[model samples]
Target chain A: MKLTRYNPSTLTDFDSWFRQPFVGFPSAAQVFSDSGSNRLAADIQEDKDNYFAQFEVPGVKKEDLKVELNNQILTISAEKKQTAGDTEQTYSLSRAISVPDGVQGDAISAKLENGILTVTLPKAEHRKPKTIEIA
Target chain B: MTTNCCNPSPTQQTAEPEAAVMKPRYFVDGTQEAYEVRVELPGVPKEGVSINLEENVLTLRAKRTPSALSDWKTLHRELKGLDFLLRLRLNTQVDEEKMTAALDHGILTLKLPVKEAAKPRRIEVQ
Candidate 1:
């Protein structure tokens, strides 16, 4: 009897291939929602003075984008509408990130440019790092 | 020398580089007259995007603007510093000369008009 080699990598390859629909050709909705999660991907970075959060939100108008900060939680919500032929489609996506300490909530500012929403949270005056000189 | 049956060899594993080029997410829709393709290319300026059509295949490439905040500490990251490359094969004939493209809010929209001869026409009943 001939024996077959059990390769574990093949299982992972098959799993990823099955997750993406149509294999080589992906439709618009499939790529937009990301396997039906409907959650927007984001990146957060911090410097000595400020914390920056960037969100990828394509095909969304500025008026439809909303950013809210409450109780140390930053929430980003957006709505995208598309009309093709006789059908109309609307997709809503929202994601929240907990803010760290020492953030100036009232001074937070958000800007939408080139399909990216950057929310900048400045650190409070006392929260900034102080460079003490040697006496 | 001895080896486990389930453990794969170290040389067989290939690790993809973190900065490798990636295909940006896109959506395509079409009506009878034209097809609309929208590509999400965040952090890429209008001048960094290029579209080319050769034969029946359409190619789109976008280079993202490099981040200047390299000294900042990353708290969480989902975006990568990689360019976008996408190639699509068109089964239907398209009017290449009449095609139009627009970039707004980091999203690129391409409108490919269908060839007049290839458009579906309803035959009149006698």
Candidate 2:
């Protein structure tokens, strides 16, 4: 379904016109809306011991990904693009996570492999190894 | 013609200053020769671009000239950067050598053919 009037001169637009393309959904103008980076489908797993955050970033490179931490808030951002004459397409995704105090931001570690980005935030030393006294 | 991350502009001097959003369309057809996947990436020039098969994955990345940022008098807004990344995981039965890509008027066409053993065959009646 074409949301706009048809332009016969551009064959490229005619080729992929959907039958019922929704306005909200990403179109040629909004392809980046559903892009791997900006619209992340992530899962955050947490336990009594630690918190695990896994972000989905398909078709992204390690060099293009960025991770930042400020005031106990962690942010992850990535950008990927394809440029042509008179057209530059860019896809970007960013997410900010709130972390409780006492967790060391300096010790955070992140790795990107096979399009999935995994971030590991270890618990503080004092938070572990509690001594149980016999009553 | 250099496009900056600070500005969302296309390099075409005559083209309007409005941001250009690219939509890469594809046509996929499976046949006896192979499964053909043709992606439409328009305005891509033909030079210093490579298509390679690594561990059954088809990756397409090209380094082209920077887009023209001079089209705008003052950089007000920026949306996308200057680059392209397209990657695909191929089927085991695909013939990588037979695959080819061509760029014309911003359309990128990729032809991937199938392997002989994977093609469907009719059984002879005894």
Candidate 3:
């Protein structure tokens, strides 16, 4: 089975329909716009048994974080609050990643340490490769 | 055949180097008594963080703990392993001896108290 890469900034349905004619040309506005706050950077890795996904979420408390998996779509969300003097501000961040087949969703686990969130997805037993001997 | 002696060989050229230093995101706010600074340093541990105050400038540096995933294959990558550095020039006078700092959940918070002499004073009319 093939796995689709995680891309947070992909255009939506409405955007794709409107920008179909200008697919080859890049927009100047997008080149200079600052989208760092709206998107979270992530690193995805895989081994023989498990897949790891890591994200940076500084200044966010564990209580304010939410992780959910529905229809093979894993979503992570958090709200970061900052207070200065008398004024307080809250920033919301969210990201979604598509999980591949043969994963044990029930046994998946997540951990947050040093402002980094790591999600581990273990592969199923049948997904492991087996070697057979010929007589 | 002519030899290109002046030009360096392709093997001598070095590969692209990774970014050595990065400025971490930070916020600063000031009130009547003190100034508060918050710096975001993801993946940095307490032992790798350092703060220095000299003259009117404050410098902060943090190093992230190295990862031990050499055997894993990377499917997608966006985060880089780089050290964090930030420098700020303080305009107001602060008491360095009374300053305090704390690190929690990868966020460093610093409180620099305003000097007594620098605080605003009111005078009554004669």
Candidate 4:
């Protein structure tokens, strides 16, 4: 959706109008917007005693984030809002994943920093990854 | 996962690259006073981000720190350990000197403030 009437003519029609030497390739503006809900990229990392999930949730305020854990299920939701003039806009995104067995529900911790959200889930006392030496 | 994050920014930037640099997905929103540009750059550290504006062109580059997975198993592959690279042609209307940028939670935001002369002004009553 085009939110503004301002057209970036300089950015879009530079090579075509001015740069004659660069005739083959004119347009250089590569604009990408992933408004899809599934585009929220994430990664899962695990250690001996804990599982850590790191994901990109930028431009989302802390108060707009809603995270819930229930029955080994983890759900993350966020809403981003921007107000300009008389227009108020909102972008809502939600993603969920299932936690492995033996993770401590009470110990799950989440932190949103620098537009990145990191969630850590600790393994139960006896569920830690076992390391055994070969005989 | 789609863009290769190792190549350099293109002089005449295009939609696709030569599998050398990672072109992150981003969105640009503009207001009368400022234009907000947000790019997704997961795991990129503070020191890894670099932004340069020359003439009417802006280049954005960042390197992402790898995850903490010990003995990783490739059951699924989506997000890659990559570097972000993007080049954009800025209009003369953009005030580069007044531009500001910030990175938070894997997102990079660039605030391009409009020049006073470029901004629309309200006329006083006669």
Q: Pick the candidate with the highest DockQ.
A: 3
- Evaluate residue A62 in candidate 4 and report its C-alpha lDDT on the 0 to 100 scale: 82
Best by lDDT: 3
lDDT of 2 by residue, A1-135 (tens): 125555556533212222212223334224333343355444444344444556655445678789887666566787755444336677787765555545667888987643456676766776644779999
- Decreasing DockQ order of the candidates: 3, 1, 4, 2
Q: What's the CA error at residue B84 for candidate 2, in Å?
A: 25
Candidate 4, residues A10-108, lDDT tens digits: the string is 433212222221123222111112345444455666667676776667667789988898655576788876544357889877655556667899999
- Candidate 3 chain A weakest lDDT stretch, 10 residues: A13-22
CA shift of B119, model 2, Å: 19
**Over the stretch B1-113, how does candidate 4's per-residue lDDT look in tens digits?**
11111223357455564456667877666667777777777678889899987766678889766555556432223456577887776553678788898887677878887
Q: Higher-DockQ candidate among 1 and 4?
A: 1
True-contact fraction in model 4 equals 0.28
After superposition, the stretches of candidate 4 with alpha carbons farther than 4 Å from their true spots are: A1-39, A82-86, A131-135, B1-20, B30-34, B67-76, B104-107, B113-126
lDDT measured at residue B100 in model 3 versus the true structure, 0 to 100 = 94
Candidate 2 is graded, for docking, as incorrect
Segments of candidate 1 deviating more than 4 angstroms: A1-36, B1-19, B121-126
The CA lDDT of each predicted structure is 0.72, 0.51, 0.73, 0.65
What's model 2's overall lDDT? 0.51
lDDT by residue for model 1 over A45-132, one digit each (tens)? Answer: 7788997888878778889998997666676889987665567899898765556567899999988877778899999888888999
What value does the lDDT take at residue A103 in candidate 1? 83
